[model samples]
Target: MVLGAACATLATVAALRSGPAPHEDGSGDGGATGGPTAPQAGQALAVARQEFGLLSGGGWAQAWDLWTPTAQRAVPQAEFVRVNTECRPPVGVPYVIDASSVPDPTTVRVDWHRADTTGSATLSYRAGRWRFAPDARTLADYRPGADRLIQNRTAAGSCH
Candidate 1:
């Protein structure tokens, strides 16, 4: 029985592998269009806006939930929230998601202008939703491009 089960599993795996790969779901997540569709791009922008809303409202933990898996791995949940709170000012000022560029189905670059300053973030898509994907260690370990994306949200500062 065990041998038979193993053979069946092997056959199933072979059959699945012989078919189309998983990335070709045709929703444009990773299909022939080579990038996200217009609607998917718009969805990414909406998610970005939602994140900003959460940040400005002092929803630290909720805001952290918007981060990509990779980013979240760099810090624990409480640490992520604490870092963000300690870096940026309170979010009540007028801010515009001035630009959202979708270079591929999996990635979107978002820019926002708030008061006299501008900030940006690169978001990655998975499970039909966008997550903020900033590459960094601690708050200040940012290269120039990353510096612009989060608009220095991780810069050295006091929460109040």
Candidate 2:
């Protein structure tokens, strides 16, 4: 009974946290849908927060787990670990939740700042939830010097 109550309470909290989008009315940069679903926005924020938290704390494996299925499929576990470990080593902590922008009802962009630099990510609404689905450009060209032409590169562990 106690466990069930706790679960119910948590669910309620989650629902409450997922309030309506800034532009809940049928018009705004938020998109074609009437508005971004509350659950989607909350889920995206929760996932982003958790991932950033783990990454900032240097828990590479745990942070990798926070990634969406798509991200996991795109980058292998080893590669994800390597990337986060290398790029976010000094990311300090994911202490700050920078402002969020709903470019379209289907997309929300969240930016994070470390000690001296910043990183931004976008989440898209899919199946009634906010998910990480960056554009082809972002996925293929994360690094500044990465190849711009990433059409059909065949590699055993290629993210593109």
Candidate 3:
């Protein structure tokens, strides 16, 4: 399973890299000058990709480390691992980051799709780094023993 996940991560990375060449500042503009938010958007997208890679590779602790402080406070590390491990998302499924928008100077919204699942996540720039900031719904759904989100994902064929 770990091997499969690693392969998937590699494939995902390859797909992303092959899609477009980013500017020196990390903006996916092929050296074209983007707006003020372009660099920050790129940073948030990188952080989001790293978090998802960690999750897909079963690096739960590392993935949790990328969560915002508020998200960490809402869901304990053990509970997060337990829930994810119990039902685990499918391995080797490539995810596509569709779009990213900067809602504010400090916040970015990323839209992504994996298999049949489409979702969004918010990332906040804090203390000079970007972190996943789970919304209220996500935090609630990730609560200990909560299975609704898992069930939905499983039904959608995104998780097993």
Best by lDDT: 3
Which lDDT tens digits does candidate 3 get at residues 16-101? 43533545554324533443333356667777877777775677877888898779999999888877787787755656689888
Q: For candidate 2, lDDT tens digit of each residue in 1-160?
A: 5345334534644563354434444232343556544445656766666556655666667655544556657656676565544444444433466778778767778887766557688776544444455455544543333433232222322232
TM-score per prediction, in order, is: 0.59, 0.52, 0.70
Clashes of each: 1, 3, 0
Reference-based lDDT, each prediction: 0.58, 0.54, 0.73
TM-score top scorer: 3
- Looking at candidate 1, the ten consecutive residues that score lowest on lDDT are 13-22
In candidate 3, residue 17 scores what lDDT?
Answer: 39
Off by over 4 Å in 2: 1-40, 83-88, 134-160
The model with the greater TM-score, 2 or 3, is 3
> Whose lDDT is higher: candidate 1's or candidate 2's?
1
